[model samples]
Target: MDALTSVTGDGQHIEPRTEFAPLAVMALTGGEPAGGQMVSFFVDDPEGTGTDFHGGSPVRVTTASDGTGTTDVPLLAGEAPGTVEVKVIADGAHTSFSLTVNGHPEGNSGA
Candidate 1:
């Protein structure tokens, strides 16, 4: 299994205040069909200081026949920007990746 840095659905690297961010997960099964297979995603915040998931953690998705899947997870506004670890599990396979969320400028209050 592999996690994409920037999924095609969003076409942007995840950052602070990024809402409904699309995350793509790919699983390799020697060409085996993956349609209808369950794929689960979760975020691990070691310091307990990171972005928030709008629909909560451990979002689930169904993979396509090509063993690919996509899901949207929101990064709440004002979240402490830092390295966020994302994990994906599918068909008994697990993979993880880290993404850096750019911090918002201080004292730049929106009008």
Candidate 2:
């Protein structure tokens, strides 16, 4: 079966206006790493002008010989705190990640 599995940068937290760990994913087919595959990563805008993918959304990355596709640029958090969703898609399979901007005020997400 074709599938996508998150390799890193999932369920992580970052400080406001800071950089996050690069998100990574691997494509698997029949339970084997699928190298040279093109993976697309889409980031959700958490707080208006805050938080964003370093190179913008739907970043495309090519899997390496190890079948791991990692986002070359890091995700950026805005001045506010909130959670963002990142989706990865490849080979007709997809997966998602949740990143939270942790800080004071708990739920004080800016528009």
Candidate 1 per-residue C-alpha lDDT over 1-111 given as tens digits, one digit per residue, 9 for 90 to 100: 323222343323455666635677666555454566688888777745455567678888887777677875554522666666667777677766566666667866888
**Which residue pairs of candidate 2 clash?**
51-78
Q: State the TM-score for model 1.
A: 0.69
Model 2, 96: alpha-carbon shift in Å? Answer: 0.9
lDDT of 1: 0.62
For each candidate, give its TM-score against the true structure. 0.69, 0.85
Score each candidate by Cα lDDT: 0.62, 0.83
**Backbone N/Cα/C clashes per model:** 0, 1
Model 2: what TM-score?
0.85
RMSD of 2: 3.8
Clashes of 2: 1
